[model samples]
Target: MHAGTSNFLKAFPIKFAILIATFISLLLVGCSDEAPGAKVPAFKAPDSKAAAKSGAPGGKGPGGPGGRGNKTFAVEGYIAEFHKPSGSFQTMATLEALNRVELSAAANGRLVNLYAKDGASVQKGSLLAKIDDSELKAQLKQAESSLHLAQQKMERTKGLVEKNAATTTDMEAAEASLKSAEASVELIKAQIAKTEVRAPFSGKLGFVNVSVGAWVTTGTSIATLSEVTKLKAKFALPQRYATTLKVGNPITLIDEERAIQKVGKVTALDATISESSRTRQIMVTVDNSKGELIAGGYAKVSVELQSGRTQTIPVPAEALTLDKDGAYIFVVQDGKASMRRVETGLRTPIAVDVISGLNEGDTVITSGLISIRQGSSVRIREIRNNTDYEVD
Candidate 1:
């Protein structure tokens, strides 16, 4: 039995070795078949510039996710082009009364009567108010009585002197007494006239603060009087228009308050230019006989010069960059900004006329001045035209 057991053990080692070899072969074949469909980590190519540029559909271009590194600036654009001036040139103007004054009491007295009410139209020399003149009247009566007695006495003295009954000194003294009484009467009469306040000129009157029996002093508050029969519309124009403006020149005033337009003449022009504004004052006299035009109302003045109209290139005043080198502007050409120096002419409130330095079809950058420099790339966000039509 022992010998049989030993032989079996020896045979078992070989059989076990054979069994292990068969299992290894089967595992190798199975792996080979599966390997055909297996996915090895995809051998990815290194990132290249071409890959980034030809990025996936609908991706940003050039610089990072946001695109090109050039800082993006939002700005407005304007086109410089020729424009015609209006048929008639218009300017800012203010309307004013031809004559305006606050009528005050000239003498100190109690107001006895007020002839006109507030907002009453009065004629020149018309009685406006009356002060208490009773005291003045009595003074005049007493002075006259004294003058009568003195005159009689002077006559008697002169007769006595002529007849040698009175001395020459007595005659001179009587004459002096008579003259003094007469002078007193005249002074009282003058005072009486002042008691009756009258309108100095034809105009419309305003409200009075005091009622009847109100004691008033010299230069006391009374009422306002303005001669609106003809209103004087005063406006200022640039000094360059001084020569063109002259007396008798036709002027049209637009009353903004009343929404009415009126025709008038250039009654006067200021002799000198105002140093502060460098403008000349023009006075237009408009007839307001119907009292339609109000004093102190605003108006727009326009004058049609008998000259031809012209076209000009106008740009916004903000676009101009001024320095020691003169005026310059940034113009966008071919996606790049270029600085161009230009000569400027007349300027209005919103725009300046480009007399030189720019031509038609020029695109001027109006905004984002700080974000851009010469040769900088720009994208147009919006555009505006500041050209204006003007009459020369």
Candidate 2:
């Protein structure tokens, strides 16, 4: 019985060991299948530290993704030119006639003769208009008769006084009577001369305002006569230009309507400036041999300033810039723009004369200057076309 019980216990122990081995193999298979389905956290890409070091936003380098490098700008410029005058010209003051008069008779009389007409050429002392002098001549004849009688009586008294037969007071009374009669005759003859109106100077008579037999008063204008062989042009200039405009300064006169050009010289200038306009009056004499220029016509005068051997640079007018520092321009070098302050001289619509602050051969940006600041990059698109400047 003891041997049988011992065999049962050994079999039981072998069975338990086999059951434990089967359970361990099933557990190992389940673990291997679950390990294939399990997901580890996704591997993230490393941040672009190199891009951050480059100062690009969002860790991106230059021109990478959203970054932008230096930008290009368009601009324009021109080559400088120089100008030299052939000859200098001066400015002049205008002129006027020394005397102007209208001839009319004082008394109302018949117009005996009309010697002058419109545009009639006359000489000084020539008879122009004559009135009837018959009444004046008759008065002069009567005075002459009385003077002759007085002179005979005075002669007799003087002879009597010399012969010691007449008193000295009687000779004095006869002399006084003769003098009075002679004065009356002379006054009548002078009245006759006043009836004949004569030309005061050599000139061309204007339109005849009076006709023959036309009654005229003392102040009535008979005709207007002016000497138009030469014209006097007067102009007012600033007081500062007084020294520049002196006697004998040559000037160019232009008639805008007729397109006629004339040359003249300054004849005189007012010594003092006018208190009202603060300008000095200058006069010039222009020869109008052809009588083309009229006295009341308007004219343009140009005075050439004498700038001796001055260094000047011509630039485009568009390149000029104004600021608190006066005027300036932009200069381009090595694809960058720089500002240069300049003093400007004569300026036209298209070009300007640079007096200072820029040297010859320096490149100036004509366009895109207003949009660009100092040290900004720029790309020149094309050069501007060459243009001419007009001087007056």
Best by TM-score: 1
Estimate candidate 2's alpha-carbon lDDT, on a 0 to 1 scale. Answer: 0.76
lDDT of 1 by residue, 1-392 (tens): 99999999989999999999999988887878466557667687645555567653333544344333355556788887776654666886777888988888878999989886899989999988889989989999999999999999999998898899999899889989999999999999999998877888999898976788899998887788889989888888876456676799889988775689899999998989999998888899999999888887788888775454335677888888899999999998888789999998777667777878897889889998976777667888998745332313
> Any runs in candidate 2 off by more than 4 Å, and if so which?
1-99, 304-392
What lDDT would each prediction earn against the true structure?
0.81, 0.76
Q: Report residue 373 deviation for candidate 1 (angstroms).
A: 25
Shift of residue 62 alpha carbon in model 1, Å = 45
Over the full model, what C-alpha lDDT does candidate 1 score relative to the true structure? 0.81
What TM-score, computed on C-alpha atoms, does each candidate reach? 0.57, 0.54
Off by over 4 Å in 1: 1-87, 157-175, 306-392
State residue 348's C-alpha deviation in candidate 2, in Å. 21
